[model samples]
Target chain A: MQNVTKSKWWQTMILKTIAMVLIGFIVFGPLMGTLLWSFAEKWFWPAAFPQELGLKYWKIAFTGQSPVLDSMAISITIALIVVVLATLISVPAGYALARFNLPWKRILLVLFLMPQAFPQLPVFINMTSIFYRYDLVGTVPGVIAVHLVISLVYSVWITTAAFKSIPVTLEEAARNLGASRLRVFFRITLPLATPGLIASSIFVFITSFDEFTGTFFIGAPFIQTLPTLMYTASMGYNMQYASVIAILLTIPALLFMLVLEKFLKAEYISGLGV
Target chain B: MQPRAAVKRPSIRVSDGQREAVSGLVLVLPALLVLCVLYIYPLCASIAGSFVSDEGIGLHNFAKAFTLYGTDILFTIGITIITLVLVFVVAVLTASFLRFRNWPFLNFVYRLPLFIPYLIAGHTMRVFLAPHGILNILISRVTGLSDLPGLAFSWIGLVITFVWKQFPLATLLILGAFQSVEDSYIEASLNLGGNKVRAVWEILLPICRPTVLVAMVLTFVSTIGCLTIPLLIGPSKPVMLPIDMAFRINYMGDWGVANALGVISYLIVIALSMYYLSYTVKKEDA
Candidate 1:
């Protein structure tokens, strides 16, 4: 019995080690390869590592000749616009959903969520006609408008969750103490909900930044974002340039994820259900 | 506690209620307007566009779309199903292990993919799975298989990329469900002569069914509609639905057929949405 138990312990330990190693490979293998490939000058097969490394691709990525720098700027500009517009629009709607007893409240909430329910392909394809009519196709604002359709859902849901989590009694108490509604909101409610609001904004920003299909459909030819640039490079077999672009695209998202780490658990659970 | 106060407050509350209603409408109006113009209008136009063609408003375009892109639609569905199964299995195992086991780094590793975008993930897959990629190098070195087939630009690569990008979300969702499971149930199962696997299967799985279902539906819908992974890694022939629809527009300039395909995709999403809605409503009622 002692020997059997000891063998079982060894078996479990080995299994766990293998599992951990496999998980590590799955998570980090591609990421590491991409990082190495970005800097590699001659990373041929049948060798364990890159034969030589240089900053040629990185230089190209940073130079004005390549679309990388411009794409990054465009992506950031569009994402910021999306974040600002989504926040401005969603905050009031979220506040209403949280504080008021509106008619067909559930339906309204579902309507906000409906944008995400369908595939973006259909919507963007359909919008291409209207955008063409309005002369908005291949324009940054047009892409931003399309992105708003998806980003608004998350922004509203998350911001509503943020508002819902705030205690009503605090607002009422402030009101009773002769504080104006605006003052109560700005002073009392806004400060408390700042973290969640920031988190939701980050979500909106990332969603917009990572938006590919809509941007590709609407912003092609005239507007080139990082994702669209990456797609073009990858399709054109410019692996080295694509790697650099991928890394650039990942940096902001990674930073935001770290910032979102604290608030994400609560926000995802509470906000996503509806 | 407030019968007298309630009666006394009604007169003051009447005007307050009206003011509140007005403010509520005002608050939601901007968002409603944006949704109406950006979202509702586009949706209506899409539906309308799908039904209209050269021959007038009919199902002709849809029939063409079905006959033309049927394989692509089926392929998309097949990939979604496969990805869903793989994601579900990986998510459940990883989530349960992280919950019950004392693997601290597992949680961090599982979540790392969440930070990576689909575009980057696809790039990573291509980098690692190419003919001269690191994966082939390792396989050749270890297994002595010199002529191993390249996995890049294939359905397998697409699956790998999709699973890598999406399974983190599934794990997180399932982990949330796992967090709500009572420890005592597992202990009780153990005390009743069940092993850990049996305990999970008997006690935990049933409790997590709803969350698991949600995760599956979410993964299915997202994967079926996804364009980046399949675009980057998927083969040219037997393309996914999104790519097929795109080709219809970009190459063929056939808006009618493309819109028809879009409507078909929308119907699939609507079906899933109905299921999700009913499930959430039932959960609420319960």
Candidate 2:
């Protein structure tokens, strides 16, 4: 028994060490590589580390030389607009789905979820073709419209959960007290769900901020976002420039990660893959 | 709990039901309208466009797509399957580790990718998997071998990128599931002299089967629609379906073939998603 336990313990030690090393490398290795490349003044073949490291690429990246700054501006602008629009559309829909007696409730919920559940590339491709008819293709508004598809997943689903979580009786009591229905909702439901609504908004912001597929399909070759800029730079073999912007984009994600654990419900994350 | 207002307006309550129904429709209308315009129309257009071909309204586009890009479809299937299996294994192990241990840093590290966009995942792999890149450098140093070729621009690299991208979410889901599994169940196996792996396989996994299924579904379908990882790390020749669709549309001006490929991709999603959709619906109803 002692021998068996001893050998088993040793085996576990070896296995755990291997697992740690592999996981650590898998998760962090690429990040380290990107960080090194961003500052690699003169990395060459056969050198495991950069021979020279400085912020040369970083300097060029922010200046008029690179498309980084403009892409950042456009990315933020579209995300903010999508956040506002998606929220307006979703809050009522979410509340109706959650607290009201709606017709075809299940089907409506399913329809709202179709964007997250389906293969979006096909939809985006067809959108590009359809948008051409209205001359919306390759425009900033076109990109924002495309972004609404994915951002709605966050806004609608999370808001539904938010409103669903608020006790229905609070709204009922306000209504019973002779408050108008609109007043009841605004005073009770909206304020009560505000924290979750804010979280939902942040989730929407991050998703729109990082949206790639639709932007690629609808806004590419004309309007450039950080994602498209990364694609072009990487394709053109400007690894350092791509790395710098990649790190820039990663900042919001990194910040949210600290707080994500609180909002990181399994249901919410199920909508992640765009 | 029974604090109803004694002087409640029964008349208002009766009319309130009717008003509620109207408001429900009005409130849900915007999202449904956006869904109609954004998703339903585009979807109908894609399906309709797929039927338009050189031979006129049939399987010509599909036939051409299969003849031209059959290998790419197979490649995509290969990548998805391989990534699914790897992601399942890794997720289970990571979730198991989290279940058995209390390492906060490791937990944080494992879940970080869940917060990231697929763009970063793709870009990170692009930089790391490039020829003469860090992965190669490390391999050469470890094994005393040099001149390793890049896996960055290949199907293997695509799989790696996806596993990295998809596993964190799977791990998050699986870990959440594992957290709810009664510790006494796992403890019973450990008390029987069973190892952690055995306990996981015999006790934990069976209990968490539904979550495992959900995680697998998420991992499987994710690779199908993905464009960035494939674009960044995939080989130029015989690319993934999204890449092929983009090329056909952007370069060849062949919306028929592109939309055909789109339909084919959607069919894959539909096949897998029927279960997922029903599952989600059931959960929603619950």
Candidate 3:
């Protein structure tokens, strides 16, 4: 009996360890591969590791000689613009939806969900023709407008939930205490909702940064972002350069995720549940 | 405090209600304008473009699209289904473990992939799964399995990349569901002489059905419309729908066929969206 129990304990331990190791490899193995390749000068077949390592690719990506630095700058600029615009647009709309018993509220909710739920290819294709006619193709603002279509949905949905989560009584109490409406909003509501707002902004920034197909359709030929640059380089057989850019693009997203980790529970419940 | 004063206050109350309504409309106007111009108009124009060609108002372009790229449509559906199944299995297992187990490192590992962009994830997989890539190198060294099957630019590679990129989201969502499930139900099942597997299958899964369904539908919709994974790691022959539509426009300048394909993809997503919307509505009502 004792031997059987001991063997059972060993079996469970071994199974748990196996699961942990496999999950670790599946999640981190490819990441490690990209990291090595970014610095590798001569990695080839039948070798367990790279034969040589250098920062040539990294240097090229950082220097202005390559398109990478410019593309990175373009991506950041576009994402920042998207963050500001999405926040500005979503806050009021989210507030109305959360606080008011408006007509067609359900229809409005569905309308907000449509951009995210529908296929983007059709929209991108259609926008290409309109953009061409309006002379908006190959322009930064054009690309930003298209990205807004997607990011706005996330911001509105998230901020709506954010507003909904704030207790209504707090605002009423402030009003009863003779606080002006604007003062009540600025002093009571906004501060309490800051975490959700920040989370939504981070989400908007990431979505805009990673947007590709729409950007490719609208911003090609004249404007280039990091994603489009990576696509072109990889297609053109420049994997080393692509790897460096990939790492550079990943840094901001990872940092946001780390910042978001503490707010994960709140964000998940109010921001992402819908 | 008298009747005349009450009458005056009622008139003011009516005006206040009207003002509130007007302000609410004003608040939502910008979002509404963007949706119309950027989303609704473009989608309508694309669908209309598909039906109206030189012949004027017909399914002729759709027929042309089908005859030209039927295999691509089928391939996209197949890939979506496969990725959906794999994601479901992986997410369920991982979510269960994370919810029930006490391993902090495992939790961190599961969240690692959530930060990665799809394009970067594709590149990472390409580097690792290439013909002479790190994975093959490691396998050859350890198991004497040289010249193992290459995965880059293959359907298998695309599936692996999609699963890796998407399953973390599924796990996060499903784990949210799992955390809400009561431990007492599983305990009751155990006390009733059921095994752990049976307890999970009978008690927990049934309760989490709606959430799991939502997660699966989301995975299906997103995977079907995906471009980067299929474009980066997928094969050149039987391409995915997004890639096919993109090439038709970018390479051939065939707007008619591209718009037709676009309509087809849109219809599929719309159908799925309707189902999801209904589910949410039903849940709300319940």
User: In DockQ terms, which candidate is top?
Assistant: 1
lDDT (Cα, tens digit) per residue for candidate 3, span A152-184: 877887788888788877876666667777798
Q: List the candidate numbers ranked by DockQ, top first.
A: 1, 3, 2
- Where does candidate 1 stray beyond 4 Å? A1-15, A265-268, B1-22, B272-286
Per-residue lDDT tens digits of candidate 3, residues B1-286?
2545444542212246667767887999999899899999998988888887667789989998899889888888788878988999999988887777778888777878889988888888888898888788888888998778879889999999989998988888888878888899878988999987786677766678777776887788778888888888888889999998888898988888888998888776667657766875676577
State how far residue A181 of model 1 sits from its true place (Å).
Answer: 2.0
How do the residues A1-274 of candidate 1 rate in per-residue lDDT, one tens digit apiece? 9999999999999998998889899899999888988898887768788889999999988887887878888899999999999999888988888887666778888788777656777778778878999999998889999888888888888888888888777876676667777898899988888877888899899989988888888888889998998889988988888888888889888887777888765744645564
lDDT per residue for candidate 2 within B6-114, as digits (tens), equals 2454222434677878888998888888888988999999999998987888989999999999998888777888898899999999899889998786787888788
Clashing pairs in model 2?
A: none
> Tens-digit lDDT track for model 2 on A74-103?
999999999899989998888887877767
Estimate every model's Cα lDDT from 0 to 1.
0.82, 0.83, 0.83
